[model samples]
Target: MLKKITLIFISLAIILTSLEAGTSKRKGTAGAEELRIPVGSRGVALGGGVVAEANGVDALFWNPAGASFVNKSAEAMFSHVSFIADLKVNYLAVIANFGGVGVFGLSLKSLDFGQIPLTTVDAPDGTGETFSPNYLTAALSYSRRMTDRIYVGANFKLISERILRESAVGFAVDIGLQYRLESGLRFGAVMKNVGGNMRFDGPDLEWGVVIPGSEPGAPVRSLRVPLQEFELPAAFELGFAYNLKVGEAHSLTLAGSFQNNNFTLDEYKGGLEYSFNNMLFLRLGYSYVNEADYIFNSPSFGVGLNIPLGGTLEASVEYTYRKVKFFNNNQFLTVRVAM
Candidate 1:
């Protein structure tokens, strides 16, 4: 136990040192911004502070280590988010637990931006054409119970983004660790979106340009503008949670987390949950950043219900609401099934 604890601290120190060294002054400059968006409704409702207690398929997007805590043999979840600026996010995840081997998970997240009229330098108003942008991420995850109290997990992700004829593809990884105590206390840490830079390239970046002072009737030279590569938004997070039993049928959980980002300000988050007989749940959460102009600083609210369909079969429905500063508020709905 002492060795395990020391190893955890050593790993944390290494990751923290690397993150500090990689910090950048340029904020909001990451390319794969979609990866930062929250997927599971439960985690979003918890203000992203549920890293320690997240479980089953819901953990695929938060802390993969928690995926090893699934009580069922298999679990699947589907979620939809009504995001700000009229955008929509859809997420799906499935996980299967093997008795002594490990747990494997697969997940996909996609963003939908409705068609928008194309515009150009010459046609500032409209170009009589419309295009839809596509952003998608697919991830494969593995988690194992390293010890009675230690859980470890990792996720390998493929990211793709396209706008018209230009497209960018990249890969990233997430590593997570969780430690649970018999006293209902949990600790978790995760590093997300660690990868190389991504650059856009396609036919749209190439065009024919004539030299200024060439010969008469000279052929036009094909010019291709080079695009700058952008780094991924990497973040390191640490969190803890305590589960308290109020009575035989009632319980409460309190969770808090601190997140440090490479390209943005650090954030602090806290969440509270009340549960009745493990069937009904109510949650309240809030997140704060040092920056005063952060858009998602408001409180979030959520509710959930779990029902047993039959022997070894269960279903859950959850919803969350978050207030946005300028744009419309964000809402999420999720359905999960386990057997």
Candidate 2:
């Protein structure tokens, strides 16, 4: 099973890379752009090198295949992010594992941009109106172990973006495979945000307008402006992770990932995590992005604490910090409970 999974993921990686070769980065062509933002604090702090060994609700966003690693029958997580420019991101997820039936998960992520005063051609400054833009993603995921060493999973998501009376809706899917060797080395691959294009439409786009050439006396008709369709922010990712024991209760993890992004540039990331007694964790990561791709492009740090709540129950709190160029650094806090 491991061999088969390996062959499949490698083939997929090759195919995706080949197809993406020579394709210029279409920086502004993707819709539902919020999907590009990382969801899990740990993953973000790790510079998104978490395709392997992710467990519970977090796995659904990184590499669904890793969902098979969930040791709990049920798990729940809540995450909050203080993004650049005062934007806020909130994420919530729940996972249920039913042994042979597989693992099922539901997750929601949303970005909150504070209210902005309405302005129009007639009102240059403000129209005395306010509106808030909203971006959200809702997903359902399923994963199962194909064998002791192989796991596979997929996720379907509904993505929506709304600004005042204008909005766009689209759907996407994520597929992943994971394989682990007895030596504790793990591999993972995933294809994310593959879906049809979307275009904005709403009453805001249709309003009364005067015709240039019409009869002497003509009535104004609401004309709808056509908006070009845009594809989703798609990407293919490959990653590897390994854990090494330094002492009886001390361990270290090293992870790395490479990605071919459809809407931007290719990227590589590396991360390290140190654990003490399986309860306290310290993590650091770095990411390299192709030139002119983005503003936030580098080092991140994180810390986490896990506490046992009895036999099979536990709770954890994690925090991550990311440094950006010429902007305030990003901060994320996540809380998780498992049973």
Return the top candidate by lDDT.
1
Model 1's lDDT to the true fold?
Answer: 0.90
- Report the C-alpha lDDT of model 1 over 162-205, residue by residue, as the tens digit: 99989999999999988988899999999999998999999989
Candidate 1 residue-wise lDDT at 330 = 93
lDDT of 2 by residue, 230-269 (tens): 9888888889999898979999988899888887778888
lDDT of 1 at 208: 96
Give model 2 RMSD, 1 decimal.
1.6
Superposed model 2: Cα runs more than 4 Å off: 21-25, 213-216
lDDT of each: 0.90, 0.87
Clashing pairs in 2: none
> What are the models' TM-scores?
0.96, 0.95
- What TM-score does candidate 2 get on C-alpha atoms? 0.95
Model 2 scores a C-alpha lDDT of 0.87
